[model samples]
Every structure is written in C-alpha cells, then in structure tokens.
Target: MTAVSPHKKEPYERMSEPMATLSAFAAMVKKEFIIQLRYPVEFVASFAQIFLIVVVLTLAGLMFAPDGVQSESSSDVTGLVVYGFVLFIYLSDTLWSVGFNVRREQKQGTLEQLYLSPASKFAALASRVALTLLWTGLLSIGAAVLMSSMLGELPFHNGPLALYILLMTLSGTFGTGFAFAALTLRIKEAANTAVNLLQFGFMVFCAPFFPFAALPEPMLWIAKAIPLSYGVDAFRSTLMGYPNGFPELAPIGVELGIVTLFGVAMPLLGFWLYRKAENQARRRGSLSEY
Candidate 1:
C-alpha cells in the first residue's frame, strides 16, 4: 500500500486560542443554567431569603427611629441606610455566590474534574460571576424598592454619575469575590469560617448600615484605608444629592479616583492570583482533593 499522507488537522481542530476561549466561555455560561436547574430549590430559597432579610432589617432600622415608620421620612437618613444596605446585600451574596460556590465544587468533588476538561478555568470562574451579576442584581433592585417603601422615599440625584459609581463599585466587589474564590481553593474546608470572618470585616470596616461619620475617629481610619469604603462614600454621597456631611471618607474627586482604580485593577490582580493558586494545585495533584 502507498504511504498514507500525513493526517491533516481539521479546521475545528485548529481553532485559534481566542475562539477556543470564547467557545469555552459560552459553554460555561450554559453550564450555569444547568447547575441552577439541578438545584432549583436552593436557587429559589436564596432569592427569597435575601429579599426577606433586607426587608426585615430596613423595617427594624426604622423602628429604632425615635418615631417608628412614618408616611414621610428624612431623606438623609433614608439614603444613608437604604443605599448602604444595597451595597451590603451585594457583598454578602458575592461571598456565597462566588466564594462559597468554589468550596461547594470542592465538596462535590467536581472542582478537579472541571479542570480536566478543556474548558478554561477562567470560564468556570467567570460563569459564577455571571450568575452573581444576574441573581444579585435582581435582589438588589427588589430589596432597594422594598426598603424605600419601608424606610422612606429614597433620594435620586446625579442619576448618571450614581450609575457609573454603582457599576464601578460592583466591578470591584466582583474582583474581591475572585480573590476569595482563590482563597477557598487553598483552604478547602475552612471556607465557611473564612467567609464569616470576611463578612464581619465588611460590616465593621465598610460601615454599610451607617454613614462613615457614625463610626468613631479611630474606627473611621480603618474604613478610610479600605477602597470599598470610598466606593460607598462616593456612591451614597452622589445619590443623596451631596448633602452636608456626605462623602465622609474622602473628597468626592479623590474617592472617585480610588474607586475607578479599584474597579480597573482588582479584577486583573484577582484573576492572576487565582491562576497562580490553580497552577500550584494542578502541579501538586491536589486539585481533586476536598
């Protein structure tokens, strides 16, 4: 028989890196829906629970007002509480949605197998983020509306600017979620404890329920050091019409600069750290271990 010509790679087999990445990402986005369908109850319960907790907290906060719940409410206090609560809702969910989810995969023994597939690890991480953006974004809007009714009509000002800062702040928080996911891979079972500690830190340092001015001078410095603090400051201040005593952490210009940098840089840094951790785990063959 004549020598067989060298087998040529098919066009699909020769897909470029960018196209391969896009295909993997698109598949992973579909995988998000598959996972949600498999655990429909957990998904529904989470959505309900977040809404309830926010309503209760906002209602209870108004109760603490010298005059419990009124037809009309103070715009300043209303904006401070409602806006802060909005950010809190996002951060809390990000912890569970992105960070806790990685630990979940470890416990299910899928984290390792997921990597064995040709799909990009970044696709896996980004898929969870897509879930958070959709899931939490809805919860935030619902909770905010409910809180506005319970707390008071919230001030809406600097609409376009507030939207920008809101997006930037959320972007930075997503980056934080990625970093925490990296932490989960390394710590495995300790993820719960770590999440609790992180939540407490956010509550205390970020002062999401109260204005930065309410925090003591010493405590305020800690908030000042945290970039998310600037995000909170800039977000609420702009939305509240920049009333006196707003943007307590820093000047609006300075805070905006910090939040922009945080939005741009954190995701890049967080993903880099995740890749490092992942490469190490793969090399050590610990990728499958819970």
Candidate 2:
C-alpha cells in the first residue's frame, strides 16, 4: 500500500487572525454606536457646533466682501474657507476621539479589561476612528450644504476626485491621531490637555481657514511642512476649483503626492510606536495603573 501523505496546512490558510480582527472590529463599532445612542444630546451638540461654525464664517465672508458684489473671486474664497472648516471638523474630531479613547477607558476602569481581551488593539482603535469619521463626515456634509446654499454656489467641483482626496486626507489624519493615541497610552492623565493643545495648534498653524500664502514667511514655511496644509490646499483645488494655496511651494499634484506619502508613512510609524508602548506597558505591569 502506498503511504498516504500527512495532512499539511496550506500557506494561505492563515486567515483566522484577520477573521478574528474583523469580528472584534464589528463588535467595537456596535458598542460605540450603542454608547453614542445613549448620549443623543452629544450628537446634537456636535452637529450644532459644525453648523454654527459654518454660519458664522459664511456671514463673515459675506460681510467682508467688497461692496457685497459677491465677485467670483470672493465666492471662490468663501468656498475655500467653508471647505477648510469642514475638513477641520473631520480632523479634530477624529484626532480627539482616537487620542482620548484610551484615557476614557482608563478613567472608566475598562482599559485593563480591554487589554485582557484577545482582540487586536489596532483593530479596536481603527473601529473607533471609523465610527468617529462616519459621524463627522455626515455632519461635515450637512455643514457643506448649508455653507454652499448660503454662498449661492456648490463648492465641490469634482465629486469623485474630491472623494479620493478626502480619503487620503483622512488616512494622514488618522496616522497623526494614531501616534497621539500611543502617547496617550503612555501618559493617561495628560491625554485631554495634550489633545486640546494639539487641536489648537493645528488650527492656528495649519491655516485651515485661509490660504497658506496669507501666512508670514516663517509661519508659511511651518505650514508647508505640515501634511494638513497640503490636505487643505488639495481640498480647495479639488472642491473649489482654486489654485493651490502655495504654487510656489509646490504644485497641487506634488502637494497631493506629499499628502499621500504621509498617508502611507504615518500609520506605519504610529503602529510601530503603539506596539512598542504596549509592550513596555505590559512589561511594567502598568496598563491598569493610570
């Protein structure tokens, strides 16, 4: 009788981890939604905040327009400002949600239990970020519609391109948040203050509501170095048909190239830092120490 070959595991059969990760992600998202639903007033407040920002900025733009002529240039500027603010909402919401989530869990005494679970940490964080982005995206679209109607023109020039660029922008923003989350994991008590300071710094230095050219030379250089600056300019170019805020700094295409590069690089770096922090925390038995 011929000897039967022993049953062998196939190389491609290692999908259990990914399947487990997916299951964990779905569960996390469901839990987040349920918790958020319990706080409906929070959602209402979030929506109101975006709406108020757009309305105030739209009125300011109209009020400052020379002689209320609503020249095409002025309209384009208004569109750019509105789009920038919408992007700001997305960035700030995602960053704070991801960065502070761990601290929130720690404060609730759930961080240790979370680490005890077999689910991937990255998967849990990704699900939280996804949920945050989904709600923020919805609010942003509503704000965009309100702003566009107020300005009497739609801001988005290329729907498909704008969507693609928005994804890239979100990816880079997520990376930044992921890195911040790692820092929060290491420094739980300071998480809220750190996130708030970072948000304010981004608002001032990133020039989300104005052209990069309008910044002073030193500040302009600093803004150009930031990925969000490219994202804001790319959004305006794609959504408002405006020239890049700094053509002398880089063409729109090159600016997007930089954004895409950060979109790829930052996550990898953040994940590495996250893993290192996690291991260090485990070694020190400090994951629950807050």
Candidate 3:
C-alpha cells in the first residue's frame, strides 16, 4: 500500500480567514475613496458649498456688526458661528456616509453579498465611517480657516485642547451616524428622507449655529436631551473661548463625560439593532430587494 499522509492544514491556511477579513475592510475604505474621486465635480462642489456657507455667514455677521466691535463677547460669537458650522458640516457628512452608503449598496444589489461575506458587518460599516471622518475632518479644518480669515477673527486659542474637543465631538457624531446607518438598513426606501430630517432636526435642536442659552425652556430641555448639544458646547468652549451654556456642571469636563457616554452607548446599541435588522432581512430573503 502507498504511504498515506495525514491531512493537515498549512499555517498560512489557518491564518487566511483573519487576513481576508482585514483585506476586505481595507478594500472597502479604498473603494469609498475611489468612488468619491470618480466624480470630480461632486468633490469640487462639496468644497464650494463650504465656501459659500462661510460667505453667507460672514456677510450676515458683517451686517450685524458693521463697525466690527472688538469686545470679547463679539469675538466669541464670531468663533462660535464659524466653528459651529464646521461641526455641523462634519456631523451631516458623517451621517450621509454611513446611511447613504448602506442605501446605495442595497439599491445596487451588492448589500446581500456583503452580508454573506466572512467579514463582520461592523467592520464594513466602520471602514466607511473612517473614510467619511477623514474626508469631512479635512474639509472642516479648511472651512474653519476660511471662515476665520473672512470674518477677521482667530478661533484657535489652545491648539491641543481644541484638537481634543474636536475628536470628542467627532466621536459623538460618529455614534449618531452609526445609529442612522441601522435606521437606513431598516428603512431603505425612505433612508434619504430620514437622513434629511435628521440633519434638519439636529440643526434646530442641537443649537449648533446658535447659543443653547438663547433657546426657550421647552427647546432647552430638548437640546439638553441631545448629546450633540453637549458636544457643541464643549467644542465652542474649547475652540472659541466661549462660556459653557450648562454652567451647573464643571465646564468642559462634564460635557466631555456626557459625550463619551453617548459615544460609547450609541454605537453599541446601533450595532445590535443593525445585526437584528440584517438577520430579519436575510430570513425573509429580501436583502437584495431593498
């Protein structure tokens, strides 16, 4: 009888599973970049829109203060307006990246393939989130600089502190976006409408463009309920030297704590919800239908 060799898997073969998962995630990020670059006009339009928003806000600011008062409050308001818009842009873009990406995949009939892949669903979602964060973060910085220059005000006081606040703000925003992604998976047909409504709701309730204290009592309660409200307060205080609207708690630290809780809780909740929705879709054999 011929010598029989015992069947054994190679070391590389054993490692192939994890390696493939990483490769898939990396490819997803690269694909996002490529897709954005393929439409050069859209890329340019994004930047143009940022610049136009700054111009309109600047004009309004000038009209409000034609003499350009040099008071501290005036300077703070200018910084608040500029940086607030930057934060809003980042939040909106992140939400779009997560929610719209899922909707697009479903519409193209590719989402089912992703769901069937060996890679974890969260990994795929995170890759898109990372891409959006990088793209929107750069745009936010550029927009902040342009707004500051046009408004004749410098917003960066403590560079390191400002950077920390920015990261915290992004964390909170990403959590919100992650939840929106789950919502998109559940409501693919109305995903765009949901996203638009969310953006508008945030603008009104979070008080990104205005002072939280300026809001009425009922609205103030709504603002307090939203984590982005705390994020905006922290960002404004850190980047613009503005006073914290919620003075009951210790300035930036308390706000950071609140956002940290949100940043941690929301994503976990979103992931759980997403997995359930995905499973339901798979069970119904409707993953490709949406």
Candidate 4:
C-alpha cells in the first residue's frame, strides 16, 4: 500500500445511504396505506360491489336451475361462481386502478417526481402492487365470508389446499396486472375508459362465468391460454371440490411456477419500459400534457 493515495478508497467505501431502498419502499407503502385509509368510501364500495354481484348471481341461479338440480349443489355452484366473479373483480381492480393511479399521478406531476428519486422503479411498483394486493386479498376474504353466510354453505373443503390454490391464482393474476400497468406509462389517453371497457372483454374471454368448453372453438382456445383462465379454473377446482378436473395438481404447480416467475419478471420489465417512456416524454417537454 505505497502510501495509499489520499483520494483513493476501496470500491465498497462509497458514501451511500444504507437501507435507503428499504426506507423508500416502506415510506411508499405507508403513504399508500394512509391514502387508502383516508378514502373509506373505496373500502366500503369494494365489499358492496362484491355483495351486490353475489346477490344477483345467487338469485339468478335459484331462478334458472333445472327442476331436478339439487338445491344444495346449486348453492355450491353459486358459491364457486361468486368466488370467480369476486376474484376477477379484485384482480382487475388492482390492474386497472394502477392504470388510473398512474394517470392521475402523471396529471398531478408526482409521477415524474417519483421517477427522479433514487428509489428504483421496481421498488415503487412493488409498493403500489403490495397495496393493491392487500386490498384485493382483504376484500376477497370478506366477500367469501359474506357469501358463505348468505348461501348457508362454505365452499372450502381443505383449508390449506384452498389457500395454496388462491395464492397460485393470485400469482397469475398479478402477471396480467403487470402487463396492464405497463400499458399506462406512455399511452395515457382514455385510460379510465380503456380499463372499464377492457373489463368486460376480460371477463368474457377469460371465461369467468362458465367453462371454456362452453365458449366457441376459437374463444375456447383463447380462454384456455389466458392467465386469468388458469386462475379461474384453479380457483373453481379448489372451491368446488373439483381438483381432479384440473389435471391432478401437477399442471397447477407448473402453471403457478410459470406465473410466479412472470409475476416477478414482468413488473421489472414494465418499470424499465415505463421509465424509458417517461424519459422520452420529458425530453420532448410533454410530461405534463397527458
């Protein structure tokens, strides 16, 4: 160490704010919680929407059942249908809300500020997704309880199995969410309308109401290919005691693994694309125009 140059230091000696990433993430998550808590209407509305849908579906099932279809079995189907419907709503809400949220932040200029910060884009997105997932999970559980009480039957047969299925389904849903969110970074016009309109197509093409077999040939194939289709199918398997129909859990595991991998990787890729788009917008002095 021939009189180590005074200006020279070890590679690891840079003066960095340790734990800055974690602190930023924690702060972002906390901010999200505070904002969500402030809007009690959103909290109430989520449950209300799910409750109303369950009622409509149950009443319709009761009205439409064949003369010999057992009332008890119809209730099970109703519960499964309600679960699927609520899950779709919860997942779509997470994705579309992120789109609207990014739009609002872009309009208000906080989005650019977030981009300028040292916090990683992935970190920022994770915080938002965490908040969204929390709301989705909570509302889903609450809706399940309410539906069980109303239907006078619990859909879950195996607690652990149901939980595992739910987690896998959520993994696939989050992958879809990442893809949706990535679309918002550059194409900001008609964002709200886009989310709303897309919801219908999503529900249909994903086959949430009925099995893919009931869809037309082309749509049936398309539905089977979608991530949401797997989520809905797996959910039904768990809730309807039809796990054997889902290929004995191995395919479920594989799909879940693939979805989980995509879930982690897609958001990072989305963040990269989002930042590139944002930077291009700022370079053209059009950041606030959206």
Instruction: Name the top TM-score candidate.
Output: 1
Give me the displacement of residue 155 in model 2, in angstroms.
3.2
- Which tens-of-lDDT digit does each residue in 38-129 have in candidate 2? 99998799789888877787777677666553533355665767778877887888778888887788778898898898888898789889
lDDT of 1 by residue, 1-290 (tens): 88766895555655688888888888877887788889989988987897788767777776777877664568887888778878887888787877888888888888878887887777788788887778777888887887777777789999999999988998888889889988888998898899899888989889888877778999988888999999888999999999997788778999999999999998888888888888888898877788
Best by lDDT: 1
Judged by lDDT relative to the true structure, which candidate is superior, 3 or 4? 3
Residue 225 alpha-carbon offset, candidate 1, angstroms: 0.8
Report how far off residue 235 is in candidate 1 (Å): 0.8
Relative to the true structure, candidate 4 reaches a TM of: 0.79
lDDT of each: 0.84, 0.79, 0.76, 0.66
Report clash pairs, candidate 2: none
66: Cα error in model 4, Å = 4.6
Model 4 off-target regions past 4 Å?
A: 1-18, 66-76, 243-265
* Candidate 2 local distance difference test against the native: 0.79
Better of 1 and 4 by TM-score: 1
Which regions in candidate 3 have their CA more than 4 angstroms from the true location? 1-12, 16-20, 67-73, 242-250
Q: List the residue pairs that clash in candidate 3.
A: none
lDDT of 3 by residue, 73-188 (tens): 35677677777787899889888987788888988888988877777687788888887777777887788788776666665576686677677768767767777877787788
RMSD of 2: 5.5
